[model samples]
Target: MLDLVKLSGQIPGLTQHLHQESKASQERLRRALQVFGRLQQEPQVWQSRHVDWGSHLSFTCASPAEPLENSRPKIEPLKGRHTVVATDGSQIVPNHHEIAYCSLINVGRVVLHYGTQQWPLLDSLPVLLYPSVELQQNSGLDAEEVLALRRAQAEVEELAQLALSVPRRRTTLALVDGSLIPWGLEPLSGQEQRLWLNPLLAALERLRAARIPLVGYISVSRSSETVNYLRLGLCPFLSCECYRYCNSDQAPPCQTFAPLPDRVFWGSLLQPGERSPIWRSGAKVLNPFGEHHIHCCYLNVSEGSVGEAEIARLEFPAWVAADEELLKRALAGVLSQVQKGFGYPVALAEAHHLAVVRGGDRQRFFALIEQELIRAGLRNVAVSPKEAQKRGGIA
Candidate 1:
């Protein structure tokens, strides 16, 4: 359906614009790198810098878990028998055009045992949700968002259950596809939080009690957590009042440095297999997380040349970040999986494969629903005209 000939004419101009943008970006990166180097050299200045964090509006940054100038730790080659348990989820949100007001969640679980003779465990758990009181709860989130929240909850709960199933003596690391913090529950009311947030927190608590470290892996993260923190270090004023002082048409002094992502600087600093220091996440959603506070570190999973370094953000709970041994095991397991999977975690990839629901599967799902509805003695059961037309298609 795309017109290649029409798009081809604009390619030259687009390419030129991209090249110019890239050049400018590279220059800005250089400036950011310089600022980072200076901060790294003057550890005292970075340590002593004062900024009234409360003065800012909706500000979030990375809280340093260790000294800013701490050495980049290289991931040790995973030794001895270990297990990496990963889970990912896929969902089908309720369609208004369909008769049933229902949603489905399928979570794929993978337990890969390395340096052992035991076979890997792979499975998927699918749950069907009908119209229920939980669904009707006023959570501010729409049907799609509610589905996502439920899916995330399902993934972590599955991960916890699987991790607990592993022998307590064995070293096990739990990884989910994204953030451990339940950001989706932030907008929910107290009742909704009890519905969603409490279950997630309980799952996290189970992992904590069992001493299994839970990690969230994000590839090529665009998060500016650390960059925002460093911006505070660069503030020239003793006190900042953005609205009163710096609110103007011209860019502020601190704005001179290009707002590059935290990954780019970390990728350049960390060698292949090295990880940056742990930084606490300042996301407001984490305020209610209590002992299960999320922290992050950048892992350079690239096995190629320095220029090809792949930076991945690994987020874990406060307990894992606090314990050196647990953190090491978590990092080692992730790096081993990435190397085996070719720059991506093998367990997660397999889990995703097992979790994905294809278009044919979706069509079949609705068909099953319709069959059940019909068997229930409902008359004139049919899809909306929009849905029927979509299925009919045009010649």
Candidate 2:
């Protein structure tokens, strides 16, 4: 359907623009690296200092939980028997074009035991919501978005349940695919937000009660939390009043490293199997987390070459970060998993494989729904004209 002839003419310009941007980005990274070196020299000074920004001025950064000089600490992966559990979820959103207004969530749970004869546990549980309440909420979110929130909650809850089942005698690590922070609840207030958030928090609390270290592994993370904190080191002002001043067209001194991500900076510093200093997340959504406040560190999982290491963000709860031994063991366990899985965590990969809902599966699901409607004596059962046309396609 696309005009290749017309698009071809624009490709050269697009390529040129991308090349120019790449050069500019490399230059910015060079300047940012210099500033990073200066800040690393005396991390204690930066750690002692704190910046007070207004509530309206939101930025992604974290408070240092360890000395800056501890940037890249390598620990040998834990030996002996330990268990790693991971959960991932897939969802089928209610489509208005279809005959039924319902949603489905399938959560895959994986538990792998190392240095033991015990067989790994792998299971997938699917939940169906009929007469979907999410559709009636009118919460300004589409069906897919609503289902996504539900799926996220399900994934964590399942992980928590699995964590509780694991024997406390074995050192166990709980992992989810991405950041543990519950996002997308920001726009909603009061009970609406709590309705979706409470269950997630409760699940996290279960993990805490079980004393199992929970980790959220993020691959190829582009988060700039550490970079944003480093920006303070480059500030020229005696006191930062971002809302009041620094509004002029002239760029602020901190903008020298404006576009750098924490991963790029950390990848340059950390060797394979090494992790950066832990930092507590400054996200507002975490205010409700209380004891579960998220803390993060970057881990270099790959040993390919300089500048080619695969950087991943590892997030955990306050309890895990507070205990030095637990933190090391957790990181070590995760690194061991990463190495065994070939750069990705094997438990998470297996969970994803079990949870993933393919296109053919979707078609089969809808077909089953339609068949049930017919069996229930719904003679007028039909999909929307748009959906019908889509299935038919243009010849």
Candidate 3:
């Protein structure tokens, strides 16, 4: 509707301007296509080795002066045995139809699951933090965005408490699924680091104080900064490298979501130890700024394939009131690019079918979806499209 309005009447000159701009865009894309074509034919072998995830961030804050060498408290897991549990959470943002935010916390085993309906067994974690109605209000933002962020932060804090409180037979590593400091999150700061990172540093300290270990686990593709790195280096206009061509049951790697070279722990707190300092991505020599030396653990994605596609469904929401055509077009470009990178055919774009199945009935819809699956070369198409849609659940 808005496109029609813009093209027809409202902005008057926008439609005329878009034509020229689109032509220019097409020209630029054509040149890039030629380059990509050459690169594709270069016979690069695909390797199954893990991508060096980029966004795994962790920090231990400065511990208070020891109370005359206070005795360490014994922290034990929920069950008798020492176990490592991973917790993940998903967030659905407003502009984006839904945000699948997940955090993996490693602790003593208690049947940990952090996936959506599609991810079975990995369901219902005691520490899963889904967006509650109370935290969903996105208005003119500012206050509301901060409030929602706080609620989300509080949710993680509660998990931290749970994770820390868990019994540590040895050092129980708490694997947080994403960035520790929270990406694109913070107050307009004129305040000190303590205002923001002090409490968090303290919380992590509680675990350290108890001699438990916490490790952050993150999928490479999720970090916006990490994505930006790939974008700037390889495909800036593209949202992802491989999944540009189709909307399939595939997900891009998520750990690539990291900040720029040195921004990982720019103003955060730190806990010093043998490995008390954090190393920035580009640091040729150790910098004394970030406390990486203290929090000896870090993880990241591969430098080359950081932007590659995956074989899982990732949650990227559509706009508030976009029509199917416009929605398809927007996703089409992305799906097209993703498809091209992954070596998949264009027919697999979006959620379309192999052959046009022309009914709105459940049987027809799922049948069409399954037929596409078979054509798309999915080995296991047992889960009907309808089932997948059900599993695809909301966004």
**How high a TM-score does candidate 2 get?**
0.92
TM-score of each: 0.93, 0.92, 0.31
TM-score between model 3 and native: 0.31
Winning candidate number (TM-score): 1
**Candidates sorted by TM-score, best first:** 1, 2, 3
Task: Give the Å shift of residue 32 in candidate 2.
Answer: 1.9
* lDDT, candidates in the order shown: 0.82, 0.82, 0.31
Model 2 worst lDDT window (10 residues)? 49-58
Ten-residue stretch with the least lDDT total in model 3: 267-276
Query: In candidate 1, what residue range of length 10 has the lowest lDDT sum?
Result: 50-59
**Candidate 3 lDDT for residue 256:** 30
lDDT of 3 by residue, 199-254 (tens): 55555556445543443332322222211222222323223333453334642332
Give the C-alpha lDDT of model 2. Answer: 0.82
Model 1 misplaced regions, further than 4 Å: 41-51, 54-57, 189-195, 241-252
lDDT of 2 by residue, 9-120 (tens): 9999999999998788778778877876777796654554454542323365687888777445566877899999999999887877887777789999999988899999
lDDT of 2 at 255: 79
